[model samples]
Target: MAHKRDKTPRLGVGGELWITADGRNLGSHARMGLLRAVVEQGSITQAAKAFGISYKAAWDAVDTMNRVAGEPLVERRPGGRGGGSTRLTERGQRLLERYAQVEAVHERFVEMLAREAFDLEQDFSLLKVLNVRTTARNQFLGTVSALRAGAVNDEIELTLPGGMRLVAIVTRGSTEALGLHTRAPVVAMVQAGNVILATGIESMRFSARNQLPGTVLTLTPGSVNTEVLLEVDGGGRLVAVVTQASAEALALAPGLRVTALIKASDVLLAVTV
Candidate 1:
């Protein structure tokens, strides 16, 4: 008689799992795996070696995980004869166990799903439809606060979170075709190149239709241009691309206050649907 194989052949899908707490990512497979290794190895150094990662990277991952998880996943032990050791806390053990259980169930579900025949091309098309990419540097999700329809064009006032408003100009036909109305949700996009920044103004006047005062958040300098990010009052942000020389002349840095100006006509509007 011929010998038989002990395990049956099975088809399954493999993927990594990332967990989050309250919309903040807590940790992923590698980080959590490091936690488990630390528990087994009884030291972070050994765990890092086993994982083939730097000690600093392992420590940083642990710190971030604990911070984002809102509790300590690993705790340091008091120094002993050898040295101070690192071990996973109770929460870490529980998290690892929970992840193992979920992974088992997910594997089973995916195997079942794979057994069912489906059109992969159709699914790929749906994925493409769901992903929308745009070059505009500033995009805000808001609701139409007011609508002014004229003979040829329509003026829309969009209210963002924290009661900030942005005005956009579009043709009347486009507005109606997009089903845009008061209180309707829309996203406003403005290119960074279209924004103007100003600072140290006491009594200056400008013709820009939209003037937003905000604090400089970041400045990224490139070859010839610099990208400036400002946090607006209430809740919003504006990005401006300016010459590096201009950034230096203005002395723009983090926490320095500035105003972003954009013409209403430059604000592009889009609907989710």
Candidate 2:
């Protein structure tokens, strides 16, 4: 007998977007959930694991979010033995309400599109990676937790938070120039363009150079622009802003799958956090 088929990933739209009153976004789907969890659960650690993310990444997402908004969405007391509880300020709660309204509409729109896009069983792929660029993708700090030499290039692997790891291709000279070593921390960033989005698949999985799973933390709304937040797995966050129309087209939400794309050229390495 023949087996059943799997669903293809398709972009969905028609959801409500949650943004701060001042117009700064919190983060994207999962990040938003994490924010809410921090409020509901009372700790970043709890929220992170509840969402299948790492504690550091959750707080990192929160920190970047705080920086972006010019306001602290989550505030911590910082001295309880069991740890203080996390709560969303008035701003965070309001943001969620608005997001839900938009989400309902956006989901319906995407559902309609899915019907006509193609067979749900069609094989389609989706992925997210991490990259950073400053002077160039060439100059970045990276760790040397593991290495394998290939004829043309050596495969260098580094450990990152959120249980995330990064792999790089470099020549012996380049590796030596940077002095890659074990237990050393490096920064990783990716160019935005290397990231791709596809709609119609029920679920998404990625195996690119580096993929960080983050929560849709917040959305910043502007007359012409929209910012999306992603709270990564290892206590890191990503923010992407684009046109309002594009936000509508993507059907972004507060509890969506947010993947950060990393490109070799866009990734920047640093010795420090």
Candidate 3:
């Protein structure tokens, strides 16, 4: 007789759950398990033994969590004849309960993701986008709407999602190496320092190739420089770092209309393979 083949999926999704506060890790499954053990054992020594950790290590973890949480999650009970007991505080119990609820929802999400991730190549591309990190303050995703080739250089025009246009100048060799073509998706990166902020230039001509008009959304002043964020026409934001003196001279303020001037040579283009 022929045997039936196993129908189980070869690919599965799994993840560990963690609780964090202010970007600092505060709790995890192993830590929560230690807390649960303390509740059941009523002794730090016993709990550490059951949790497969040293007693000192367990106490250190509890102390760190308590300090980060701004309150004690575990407390010591006065000893009688045997010894003092360890117990979870009210807040500790609530944390475990909430973690359980969130973990259930997370498990369901992972299940859905695994089911939909049959196309690994496409999903991996999206993961690549999420993992992209750069020092450039302004990164725009768009398509190459036009390209002009010259003897030694090429000018590339990118059309942003909201129909806004950006011009970049790159070497002809770089363009050919990137295989750039019209309608090809690309990322344009411009450092905040490279962007120039201006106001009242409606009829004036500028040497910069890209001029984006927008309203100043925020101004973060540092000791020597001010970082200005502008909300442009296509729901995109551009960040410009200028000298505090220059910012004061320009009278830049939130909600004030301004324009960002970027030279084509200052813009950098990138594409994902």
Candidate 4:
């Protein structure tokens, strides 16, 4: 008897094309469309209408692009009988042509990615992790190693890539809301201010649930506070902010071994949907 074939869906890759000048956004697909419309219609008002944007908004975009490019892309042409018309400058026309070439190449690149990638979902998830930003200074990507449920809170054990583990205490509501489970990927965040630093605590015990020992990588002093960067074991880094006086008291300096103490509750857990 013949067996049935699997019918699982596959993921695709896609991206937007943008041109930048001096780190500033100069043009995009929509902006190029507006330029093309101006070339065909020969009227800013009509171009704006075709581009589905207000006249002023279109002018603003054009002005920004022109300023960033250090050259006028679109210009007004004096008309004899009818109102003045709008047209693209020589540079503007060249820019449009070049953008078309780049867009075609970009389309092919995305198509290749979609066709050649064996697992697009994992690639997309990695992109999402790289794109995450937060005010917290410490961010670690790890997987859930264990979970212990409590009456009102849940104890979560996260294992980092280098074999180091971190424990976090999150409310029961958050545990359910994040859909956290064993072996699930998660991001752990801890603010610099929440981290405490100590030196020569090899034999002493700490009430804090997390004690990460590492060498002082760097110490940055500020007016009132000092930023300490630690190169922890398992190839992870932790940043801690301590007062200038406290930093001096511990003689915190690069190459000195120190421990970062953090409460289990201070670690924030997040997962991508």
Candidate 5:
């Protein structure tokens, strides 16, 4: 008697695709659709209503896209009687066209894959392995230089590119689970907020386990916080976020020397395998 095939890995062709610039999400279907809606409706309020999202959310998304993209995607035009109307900029139209092209190609690719009847389970597993998205702004590929195992948490020293060393504290169970050992290749992730920046206080040693001195490369100030990019001595870039007030207090500026401080516990560890 014939048996029914397993339907564990039921594949689908639908998924959200997005574009990011400088690690900031710049465009997506939802955002592009909002832009299109605004162009059609001629008002942000109307567009938001059509998109079923709040006015503030739509405005904030447009603001972020504009700031991150370094180009205004939408513009407000002053009218005779009314205040203003929303319209897409030339670049915005081009962006929408480009996104449409990419989405078409992506859909075609998925359709082709589906028609081929590929090993659904194996393909999905591989794709899952490749999709390593994390919120941490700082990621480094390194090798475990040293590991000290204890009853509870294990201390690991990772040697990164450009002669930099990062320290991570993990549970002993995690250490064994990830097969973390001396000379094991691993990735270290640290959130930008976790990294503290210190300038002109290098003489005073901090309690933080990791401190790397570097030169400030760029400072991008946002409304609430500022992102400072630093180039480490050997060869690596570190990102640190500080409040506008703190940035001003520290006098963060390009070419200024600063030290990045991170606690070992703040560092997260991951392995490809």
Candidate 6:
């Protein structure tokens, strides 16, 4: 097979990530690169240099990942004469495989944006790196502000730094289950449809939609669902999972005044609207 020119890179979407959709936060790009290089070179020092990180930093990342993953992704096997060489475990191999798969999709998505979202450079005026997930599952993150007890679920209100509020109905038992309370940082996870997108002067402005001016931060092409990130004022950000066709039509970008449409329905309203 003919090898093609190098292309595509995965970047972190600013703010909030659902682990279900994003794989575990075992480590980030540099860390993964370091791991792969270490496995290839069989030396932490060489791998660290290959990835442009210090030997100690690389070692730290590996240690932290091993700690968080609850499994060793790398193993050191004694070499005949050269002391020892490093190799990935079955667990490590699977981790690398999943990472590679996600990376391919990520690169492909960036390419899709460069083509489909041409105005992104002009449309997006702001962006920030909030978090990255190994999985792309539905999730939300914010500071908990209010909580109410109910017959069934506890209505918990999460207020984002930008003055946006999200109310979630968690079972009273489940609320107790999570031991949630005010001022607590929480992440909300739901289906893709749970998130909505809107532009200016649209009749479909979600009452739950948090309005802000932003540009198309990024667009990643998904086989079935495309992902779009919008950067809002004051470094605020949000992600919209929409069809590729829609993203092309709206031409969402960085300097554009796009309202992040979230349905109060998807998010509970703690106070009367």
Cα deviation of 79, candidate 1, in Å: 84
Model 4 steric clash pairs: none
lDDT for 195 in candidate 2 is 45
The residue ranges of model 2 lying beyond 4 angstroms of the native Cα positions read 1-142, 192-207, 221-225, 241-246
- For candidate 3, the TM-score is 0.54
Winner of 1 and 2 under TM-score = 1
Ranking by lDDT: 4, 3, 5, 1, 6, 2
**TM-score against native, each model:** 0.52, 0.40, 0.54, 0.55, 0.53, 0.41
Q: State candidate 5's TM-score.
A: 0.53
lDDT of 4 by residue, 130-198 (tens): 455588888887899999999999999999878989999999999999999999999888999999999
Instruction: Report, for all candidates in order, the number of backbone clashes.
Output: 0, 62, 0, 0, 0, 26
How many Å off is the CA of 84 in candidate 4?
A: 52
RMSD of each: 21.6, 21.8, 18.7, 16.5, 22.6, 14.0
Worst 10 residues of 5 by lDDT: 121-130
| Stronger candidate by TM-score (2 vs 6) | 6
- Residue-by-residue lDDT tens digits, candidate 6, 135-178: 32344456779888888867787876567566676678766766
Please, what are the lDDT tens digits per residue for candidate 2 over residues 182-205?
A: 665665545443443333433765
lDDT of 3 by residue, 153-252 (tens): 9999999867999999999999989999999998889999999999899989999999999999899999999999999977688999999999999999
Give me the displacement of residue 172 in model 3, in angstroms: 0.7
Residues 32-74, candidate 1: write the lDDT tens digits.
Answer: 7898899889998999999999999999999998898898989
Model 5 lDDT, full chain set:
0.86
What local distance difference test score does each model get? 0.83, 0.61, 0.87, 0.88, 0.86, 0.63
lDDT of 4 at 228: 93
What TM-score should be assigned to candidate 2?
0.40
Of candidate 6, the 10-residue stretch with the lowest lDDT total is: 125-134
Model 1 misplaced regions, further than 4 Å: 1-130
Find the candidate with the highest lDDT and give its number. 4
